[model samples]
Target: MSEKSRDINFLKLFGKNLRSIRESKEMSQEEFSSFCDIDTRQLGRIERGESNSTILTVKKIADKLNLPIKELFEI
Candidate 1:
């Protein structure tokens, strides 16, 4: 796949996973960001697919939320 297509797919998946997990944990963006040590603005960007997070950041979020990265994409 082209880089653009890959980016689109990945971004969509990431955003979807973020919303699902946040809801599951009963976390508002502010709450989740506090748990994950990220700013609410950054979390909003992530949920909107507007920011590309680093692997370490993603891992921190997954750990903070008590989820595996794979489970983050679960439907």
Candidate 2:
């Protein structure tokens, strides 16, 4: 399909993976956000694939989760 469509799909998949990881860790969005020093609403937006995240933001998430950066991109 189109480039935009591919980007959207990537975002959705990333969000789904992130949500799964968080749930597996038994952390609520609020708790994860606080630990990551991020806003809860913004974390929700990211998890919902409603926002485009920067590398830095992703790094922060990976760091907070104690996961490798590459793991964040895993489907």
Candidate 3:
């Protein structure tokens, strides 16, 4: 596979993990965005496996969702 394809696959995994965690918390993307003080569009990108979210972003998301950072790993 090409490097771009590999990156896409990895992003898809991350997105799936993020979506699962968000759904498990019973939160919408909009709500999560609000809680994290981040842009909804950016959150959508993360959900769609388009953007490479940083550790800081992940931590903010976890904090917003009231979930432990460990929960993200289980994905």
Candidate 4:
């Protein structure tokens, strides 16, 4: 209904999709974060939709997961 709401919804969806993809690969948050060289707490926040991630960070995650960046946003 509002721009802010839309953004929040997008973040939630992205987080959900990311979490699903990560879990599907059978990787724990700690393991994936280690592989991606990202902070585990930050990854947890991203997966919970509690924070917004930079494109660079997203790219790093995609690269580590061997997935296209766009796939992270898929519903």
Per lDDT, the best of the predicted structures is 2
The residue pairs that clash in candidate 1, if any, are none
| Model 4, span 1-75: residue lDDT tens | 999999888888888988898899899999988989999999899988888999999999898878888888878
Q: Give the alpha carbon lDDT tens digit for every residue of 1-75 in model 3.
A: 999998998887888898887787698989977878989999899889999989999898788778898777575
Candidate 2: residue pairs that collide: none
Best of the candidates, TM-score: 2
Displacement of the residue 71 alpha carbon in candidate 1, Å = 1.9
TM-score of each: 0.83, 0.95, 0.78, 0.93
Please, what's the RMSD in Å of model 3? 1.9
Candidate 2 segments exceeding 4 Å error: none
Clashing pairs in 3: none
As for lDDT, the candidate ahead, 1 or 2, is 2
Better model by lDDT: candidate 2 vs candidate 4: 2
After best superposition, candidate 4 residue 38: deviation in angstroms?
0.6
**Poorest lDDT segment (10 consecutive residues) of candidate 3:** 66-75
lDDT of 2 by residue, 1-75 (tens): 999999988988999999999899899999989989989999898889888999999999999878899999989
> How does model 3 fare in lDDT?
0.84
Q: Candidate 4: where are CA atoms >4 Å away?
A: none
